[model samples]
Target: MEPIVILTLLAAMIILLLILGAPFKSFKWIGTGAVRLLIGALFLFFLNTFGGIFEYHLPINLFTASVSGFLGVPGIVALIFLDMMVVN
Candidate 1:
């Protein structure tokens, strides 16, 4: 689809939601998930920065971010383990 068409549809949806008043619970859940994803990405960024010294680098993408965000430190460790044992 065209960019303009997608934007128009998105705008219409937003306006409709505003008029209809979206559920507070859903918004809260979405906000929490978004924050977690951001935190997860930050974790990966720091890891890459320091791990670079050890030649350790993990791609920052949706799957990794989600795992780290939702599962926290253990998730990062697991990814590292997988990278070392499987990828190599």
Candidate 2:
């Protein structure tokens, strides 16, 4: 994309946020969500690392991260199920 188009889209996004009147609050939620994503990723990393000892490893990528991030513990469980039922 052109720089002008990028700027326009960015400006439009900012304007929309301002119109919504909760930009800062939304950013707070974004920050919290980002933290959750990181935590979930780290949890999966540790799980994969430890499972390596047992010759079981879960693939870590955007899909898994999003799953774990959005769904929390249930997401981890689902990944485990996938690993056991599908990958294995």
Candidate 3:
């Protein structure tokens, strides 16, 4: 599909949702979650990069990203602990 067509469709969807009075608070949470997810993914990427010196690394994937995004710091710790357990 063309870019213009896609954008038009998106705009129409937004207009329709607005006319229907869609709850925007949920959208706010979704946006926030997306931002947090990106941050979490980047955090894991950097951790593995610098951690190479300490012989530490964490696999960055959808599962890890979602976990860290939803659970924040504790999720990363959990992944580390799980990695250690599996390795040992």
Candidate 4:
């Protein structure tokens, strides 16, 4: 019932589902996008502090948003990776 316990359980479930390649939809592309969206939203909302503690905001900001608008999804991925590594 604790938040940490719930998060651990959810994370474990996702790991299991991914490893098993459990298809969530009949469509492959849609299913993959749905999974990524769910996982990203979960982490972004709950774990923003993990990135924030280091003043490491994802390039989801103004500058990168412009780049993202031009470069699309790959740009966002680069932003995410940069944010993740900023603290390390």
TM-score per model over all chains: 0.72, 0.63, 0.63, 0.38
What 10-residue stretch in candidate 1 is worst by lDDT? Answer: 13-22
Ranking by TM-score: 1, 2, 3, 4
Q: Write the per-residue lDDT of candidate 2 for residues 1-88, one digit (tens) a residue.
A: 7645644664565455446644576586765555556556666876776788998777777788778878988999998998789877
Global lDDT of each candidate: 0.78, 0.71, 0.72, 0.56
lDDT score, candidate 4: 0.56
User: In candidate 3, what are the lDDT values of residues 1-87, reduced to their tens digit?
Assistant: 764564466456545544655368768665556556666676686678778999997887878877886788899889899999987
Of 1 and 4, the candidate ranking higher by TM-score: 1
Q: Model 3, stretches more than 4 Å misplaced?
A: 1-23
Q: Ten-residue segment with the worst summed lDDT in candidate 4?
A: 59-68
Q: Give the clash count for model 2.
A: 0
Task: Report each candidate's C-alpha RMSD, comma-separated, in the order given.
Answer: 8.6, 10.2, 9.1, 8.1
Clashes of 4: 0
Clashes of each: 0, 0, 0, 0
TM-score quality measure for candidate 2: 0.63
- Can you rank all candidates by lDDT, best first? 1, 3, 2, 4
The number of the candidate with the highest lDDT is 1
Candidate 1 residue lDDT tens string, 18-53: 565536876866656766776677778778878999
